[model samples]
Target chain A: MSNFNLKVPTMASMMANGETPEILFWVGCAGSYDERAQRVTQAFAKILNHVGIKYAVLGTDESCTGDPAKRAGNEFLFQMQAMQAIETLNGYKVTKIVTACPHCFNTIKNEYPQLGGNYQVIHHTQLIADLVADGKLKTKDNKVFKGKRITYHDPCYLGRGNNVYEAPRFALEALDADLVELKRCKQNGLCCGAGGAQMFKEPEKGTKDINIERMEDVKESNASIVAVGCPFCMTMLSDGVKNIDNLSHTAVLDIAELTALSNNL
Target chain B: MAIIAQILFLLAFISAVTLFYKNFKKILRNIQLGKSISRNDNKKLRWLMVLKVAFGQSKLAAKPIAALMHFFIYAGFIIINIEVLEIIIDGLLGTHRIFLFLGGFYNFLIGSFEFLALLVLFAVFVFLARRLVLKLKRFSGAEMTAWPKKDATIILLTEVVLMFAFLIMNASDHQLQKLGQAHYPIAGWFPVSQYLQVVLPTSAQALVFLERFCWWLHIMGIFAFLNYLPYSKHLHIILAFPTTWYARLNNLATLDNMATVTNEVKAMLDTSLVPPTASENATFGANDVHALHQIQLLNAYTCTECGRCTEVCPANITGKLLSPRKIMMDTRDRLVEVGQNIDRNGNDYVDGKSLLGNYISYEEIWACTSCNACVQACPINIDPLSIIIDLRRYAVMEQSQAPNSLNNMFANIENNGAPWKYAAADRLNWANNLSN
Candidate 1:
């Protein structure tokens, strides 16, 4: 399998243009771990800072959001973890929070209410899209790349759980990448088979591997590079690219990474 | 014609029809979808079930004592048609127990029916024991947060008293004509009434008056019971046949198709997707009771209050705050609230508070797994799973509020080629690994 690492960005930006933001960023698990995700989170934060949105990050204290536990049916672990996250977020007086992990984003935004944790949460792509629309993240890189064909995979956590479909698409479009549609595009998008604890346990019973199935859909487009919004999908799909030698040339990069790459960062 | 007999004959026949009609309307409106009981379908299973349950008494026989008790009651009640015919001809028309042919056999049949009535009385004592003393879970009350054991006790006692009274009236009359009051052959066989016979005067006037009084009480008690049926466990008595009949044909837990309110989502509005709740009624699935159509209500009326649905429900078992029975009751409670609202201002049901929201919280709405176990367990063929799914559809499509996973899941569906938000260019990458 192909390999990629997830690393998160810094929160040095939110106040660049002098705007007090309503929420804070909690760069999620995959962002902290994946190299490409780290760059995206950091660059997005820089863009937000450039745009003047005030924010804070929970820093080292940020841990795994309880989504993994809940999906695994260990609801007790999910509750405990969620309560801990909520208590930490509350300490920051954070009314709104943002994360790059689709699973984290889902847990913080959607499922946390079950544990009495209520806060307005948005995925990082949504914040980036907003910042771009507000003209904080200049699309100077948009004019440079002429023929960089790319496709996206819907990580179940981000795709099905949070419903942040368009924001990343808008971000990708804004980044000057050639967008190609997949046959099973949107809604019917097959699972990377990573959500609902499939990432941890053995998959129930499908012939093909989950991420392999997802990557195959992406490879069918023959896109030179694939853009991903969620880090877990990045790791799984990136690894999925290596199974076929000829498909070896295909590269999986985060939407953030693609944006950062286009920016000459 | 005797005035009493003429009045009773009309009342009994009319009362049965009236009770049948009321229940029939509910099933027609709720389950049949504009059709009454059989719009045209195979009834072999229904036939088999009727033969097994109604005649063979298989369902009752499974619980021997309860079966014996029920057997007495139903058998007594069924054969009592003989007594009814006798009353119409001999008692009402003043014909003196005369048979043109097979007089011995006819008398023997009457005697057998009279004996069965006494056995029926003895059997009812067992039914009372089951309904009151043992308190089966199937007979739990509407909420079942607590089982009200007393109400069932009273109803069972009343049935026994009234039915035995009818038998006493028949037995005493038969004795006067066939055996004489002194010998008391038929009355002697009935221990409860025979003891009372000893205390009363041996005069024919007293015998007639007692018979008349007992006859009036029996018939009136029957009418009162009919009216009380829809409101009590006795509703099951009327509902059981159709429930069993439908259960024989339809898979109760299998949900009906949801009314498609999403309009197939014609154009992908990426930047400006319409809010999910854009149905003409601003509804998806079952936003309101009428959104439920008729079969849903049939599910409500047909519920046996057995708690089998509740016990098998994974959501309830998982501590998710949803029970299949509670879902049914929520529908019931919603119907009541909406019904009251519609009554107050016809077609203004839209303004009232949601009865579903009060009991079936939004969290509870989404917790359901759509498993059909509850459907499978329902003896009446009520499908709670369908109702739950419809409500979930309403919550998602119309309400625009859904469980977190659901919202993102739909988003993923709308966007990242799957429920996952991966880039489209990556779709074929996985094919690289598999040997073509």
Candidate 2:
């Protein structure tokens, strides 16, 4: 969309060139496949490219982190999948990973060590916040989001699961938008009904879906834009917005997308 | 007459301690029924958690009003119990005001105890109103329909009665001291109970009887409350320390990998790796209390039935049948039932009932979003989500039962290396659209 061309390299391609990228961009299953989430992946890559930071993706070598399988009570399948992923990651000697999906970030950072795959993994929001502070990324000319009311939906894996409640907020704060908070935020944030493998299945018979209830918090915030850190939350919240008539105007964008837009990348 | 009172006091003290010991031994045995887990690591951190969360009541600060009221009651419980030491000594030695020799320090101690007794009384009234009159949503969950509701009410009421007995005892004792009655020394301050002296009889003989009656009632009520801890959610008063000490220190996102499953997967992945030796009777996951870790079982026993877990659960808030509080309650109930069953039958007998189907249903287990809000909301670090996951593990692995959607998703993961049916080759497709 801008004047610059974007470059995304693969780990294998980089290693063949006698180069090791600073961080591996783990484009999770959703970021790679889900139509809505692919845009987020593209947007984040554009930001990294504009900032002139060297990053690589696992490409076809990447696999599911088995978060859903583990949470769905398929431990054997989870370990099998985790072992495969760990093998690929360890083969690359990947010591630091950055992912837009909190699920992937959590599994690689916390759960993977137990299975003999360990790395310094961080959610993309943390990377963005750090980049902003380092003067590598600029948001001062953010005409796109100037004065827009933006609320953040905390992904459980990133927030309560990892105790990372500030990095995402810091990213949002750097923008020119008026940062608003949801009624249930941080430690008390509500789920978007897409975790624990519920994202794949119909919720077991409840009066209302969890996403719809969470959307109520978003609606009450009265923010035109709801920023999310996890791709799963993006899909669920986007679908949830379609169900509410008054919230049709509300846009759910990933924090990376917002940052890319603001930076004019 | 004095010797007779001393003998009666000795009998009461011995029987109360013995009964409490017997009941506590059963509780310890029931906790041992769960599989042993090694939480003995991280000794320094564990004690720090006990000091902060349990003793400091740090987590309760999430709700300021409840935290303040609970602090009053908690401080009263700990501080006022020191006065019990004096009562015990006086009862045993057949002495009156036995610690009066400490003089000013004794007055300071009694003065603070009286002040704390009044605060406890006020706090108990507010707690009772919160439960009975206010009808708070967290207190009225489906799991709290009967015994839980009564248990909370009974604990608060008992505190109120106990505090009243304490104040009345001090009040009548003060009046007897004013009259210079025999065995009633002019010792100890009565900062709060002095106000109640207006309600006491001025006659020394009547005042002594009133003081004696209240003193016996207060001590006996405490002993009764001590023994009742095993049967009530009020057991949190004792178990909270151990529970916080043994709580899972890992991030909630990191579900523990099944080591047995890891060995099996490793063997399959690496040809040179030795095939894992399978135990003849190893189960995949927990179906009964015995399969769960002893810490989880302790978590069940330590749950205060506050419904903080349920209150913040996404599934429960959305009207799903999955209440995290109920999961803990059901585990405890089933564990107690299993203990009774073991009592009736020998250790080898099986009742064919389990926590999975008998108490917790498949519907409740599957409804969880696993957001960890429930885990975050728990004031004492009780992890209800772990129990839910264990139940899910039993449902999916042992019985090969799961919701149809999850079953399909699992197959997709097995075949496609993702939750969906996308080819792994297509993972780089998103990058193709970018200009190079």
Candidate 3:
């Protein structure tokens, strides 16, 4: 079946059978090309399957979704690439798309319709929240994720573009994590320097790279770990944490990783 | 003398009609400055703008006192023409007293018209004092493109002097039937004209000859003004109403894309729709007068220098390079300049000067956030955002020169899925633990 199943914490994943699909994880560029994102998505897919929710994967047969090309003024190319993905999704009979990559979520959900590629797109945090709301998955309950000082990076696409400030926070709060929010979060969240395809091109002449500036705020929080809702944010912030020697122990963790580790920890 | 006046009047009447008819065609034809397809739109709203602003003069009335003075003065010009007609008729019939033909019917109309004439004169006086004496500090930035302070100063001065002379110099009319009841009451005991009239022996009817003499000067002054109008900043007077009437529906404060999601396009655009073999130097954006789109050209003509755009402009406030008024003025001035040259089979400009290094410099273009505030404040509806974007389109698509941030973004869009140089391989890195 198509990995197009979308599950929410409190709601059924799919309309049928009362069980929401396990994961609406969007397999994005990092999944297709970077191997690490591929490994994470694959692992998440396996975890969802083991948890007994019907699922399907959509992007395996697709091409580059042209969110990058369009923002870069190569609308001509973006059109061709976006059309291919739209056709693939149609062929897979996919109804909803989910992703941990803010860029993929934004492009596929927001920009795709600009190019006539319309589909229901969401983020993985949204699905995880839905699961918790439905009481489908059991948690550690002892609060394995509790008491450590931590901060969350509001990925621009998730926070600003889609207004998804709550889903990630809900997931983090469910783990009983002590959250230290940076100065810039929610509505006024800074860009992670990856939007509008800036990740592919060189950063323009801005005061500072938005991602590094965001990382500085996270460092200022002195949180031991930096949590993220987006894969691109995870990588940029992880790199940011690694660079500041003092803050290197402040590791970057996705909500999924924290959620899965909650039971084990 | 009567025949001479008749011939000049007929000649002037014909010239005015012909010139108005011809230039109207030229403006209608020069709608597009070059070849490019743009959104074709909003006809009903355009009519509404015309009906409300031009025909009704609704916008002018927003400031009540000025509007009243202006209405009386403008209506005065129309009614005074009847007096001119009576004069011409009398002159042709070889009589100095013209209203004798229609008996009291003709004289009554002339008397009423003369009454309007007197009001027009004072209305012009009020307009002059409002600008010069009280001096709305709005004129401090008297480079005068937006506020039209200099033009107002000139027009107001000329009107006051002409009306003053018009009152004094015309003392020879035998036709000015004395309203024995003093119906044309002088509002106040004025200095020059009222005293000078006292010295004239009673109705040898000097007001008759005085009216005729002043009438010629008034009519001739108007004719000279008409000829001078197309060359002056005051051209907006002639252009404003029609331009306002035919204006595009402007999206104020926030620019709305015409291409909303529901618009249907084929899977791929048809190649036939694209023009083949455009000129190598042909401007893709507004390079010359003809390259400007119709609404773009419309914006040039419809400006009413109320200074609202300048007043709210952040750049003007912060003392920055951006001036919305300058952009509008420079674009229009350049178009008029180049349009004249084109009429002579001489092109004084190309795309490079007007678009790339505009009078409003390129740096100023970057400073704009595509904010429609300037667009919003323009009472006559100038879309500064669209103009800025059109030039940006030329710079980015045609010239391949965009800002460094955009360059990086484009590069990342090509390589990574987004703009930040985040590892594309780490895309799923955020999903590491959602599963329980």
Candidate 4:
């Protein structure tokens, strides 16, 4: 996977050259460390690079957006992390942010304004949709996923949480593939069981895991590829498919990965 | 005899209204027990939410069959009550069909009321069947066990009896008018209830007695139902409007930031800045009902107990102990208990129990994924997720108790700037082999 030499720019590197990128690519905690999620980060970064979009990653300067802490009821810790991230972002005079993680996208877009760190934050799917709409990213020649059955799982934070339901679907629609919808999609989408800090702790006693129940919807959809926009959903849905029987055919791919693969970026 | 009858009617009306007012005052006081938060901004948007959600029954559209049935009941409850005005005037003035002056318009009004009553009866039957026969999963939960279960049945049965009384009253009245009874007037039309005229006795005296009996039952039932609103989940009929109006306009992803915590953290970051002083016994989050915001208390009162929140809840669907409906029910129950405590002991007295552990168990609150499905499913915008977060706050901040895994995650966030324990310098390792 590392054989491909892709150009990735950092905010510090851009600053040293007296350059300001068009947007800041916020490679979130999952995108930075988690091996599986890092692929999504690279895929999205590949799309940005291919599109000739000037974007810079915060790299080591970026910290956790404190969504998990806030949701887990550690307000003090959340504010501490948020304040530090806000100060760093403000210091760089950053105004526009794009991230592959819905959790980071949501926390920055909605919750940051209250703490005096305001910016034009968008999910990477939204940015990708715009790029396709502007004709910067061409999907017309794409044949890799043209006839494949793809179902999109709406990430809770991106869909019901902030009403960004169409952007990801629009990106998937560009693949020229047979885009199917899960039984529970858009506003009524079910959780992938990795939210509210549940990703950190073991779920309380239950007859089944929430992800397994969501996987049932995926099974019902019968789509060969399950497209997700959030890193957390990617991990949860992947684990779900592996755990469930007769689901090995289903590949959980992020919207960015699908787009990048289809475009041969 | 007519004077005595009027006096009795006046006495009943005054007492029913007075008792309802007293109970309503107690509810207001109980809500006042909660901490204050400003939901007063954006008045125009708030009113729009009230109209769209409460009056329009917009959110109920998620389940079309249930929404249509509820619309029938809601419309019947509002429109049929106009006939009650005529009944009250007739009782006081010893007049028969005082609205007869409206001529054909009175007939049109009464006809519409009769039609609505029939629809209400049909809707009630369907609702009853859904609960008892069909056994909808949404209607059955651990919280819907005894009193909550009976409460729903009782309200439906009450509606059935009241609707029957209304129709029979119209039928007997129609029969009396045909007999040329002295006090009977040929006034309103009966469309649906006209069929019931066949059930009436032929004798004028018998018809008069039956008419009077049904009329009294219908009026008395309305009064009883009014007073029952305070104790029953039926209170949503009144509270839904205000609850929708005060709903959070912000995106569901935005959890409210604690200003006090921000101040404390600011002081920690900058030594020169002084943190705001807290009360001697200030708590981080809601351990008791009084610690919650007033709107959150209103949300408890407005919960219809339809179990829609619990039905859509991931935690509950996965067979976890957490049910969002139970959270609202427990909050209301605790508030009621605290209200009773205040009435028994003085206002300052504590019950030595709280909402967190006393009613909602740690296992239940801990199971939530905070996915906002429960929040989205609430028809009237009642926020069970907010209450769950507050309870979690009490557990984490006030008690310093959390799952061991969460403790490790928290430590990682503090030390490594991410939830996972990875060195900050290596965050860019994903881009190591990339070409510039």
TM-score of each model, paired residue for residue: 0.50, 0.98, 0.56, 0.99
Candidate 4 chain A: worst 10 consecutive residues by lDDT? A1-10
For candidate 4, lDDT tens digit of each residue in B122-161? 9999999999999888898788888998999999999999
Can you list each candidate's DockQ? 0.02, 0.77, 0.07, 0.70
Best by TM-score: 4
Candidate that would win on lDDT: 4
* Model 1 Cα shift for residue B283 (angstroms): 3.5
Q: What is the lDDT of residue A260 in candidate 3?
A: 60
Model 3 misplaced stretches (Cα beyond 4 Å): A1-265, B16-43, B57-149, B158-175, B179-206, B250-283, B345-355, B417-419, B422-436
lDDT of 1: 0.58
- Is 1 or 2 the stronger prediction by DockQ? 2
CA error at residue A98 for candidate 2, angstroms: 0.8
Instruction: Please give, as one word, the docking class of candidate 3.
Output: incorrect
Q: Give the TM-score of candidate 4.
A: 0.99
On residues A1-265, what C-alpha lDDT tens digit does candidate 4 reach at each position? Answer: 2355886888889999999989999999999999999999888888898888889999999999999999999999999999999998998889999999999999999988999999999999999999889888876686898789999999999999999999998888889999899999898999999999999999999899999999999999889999999889988999999999999999999999888887776
Using TM-score as the measure, name the better of candidate 2 and candidate 3: 2
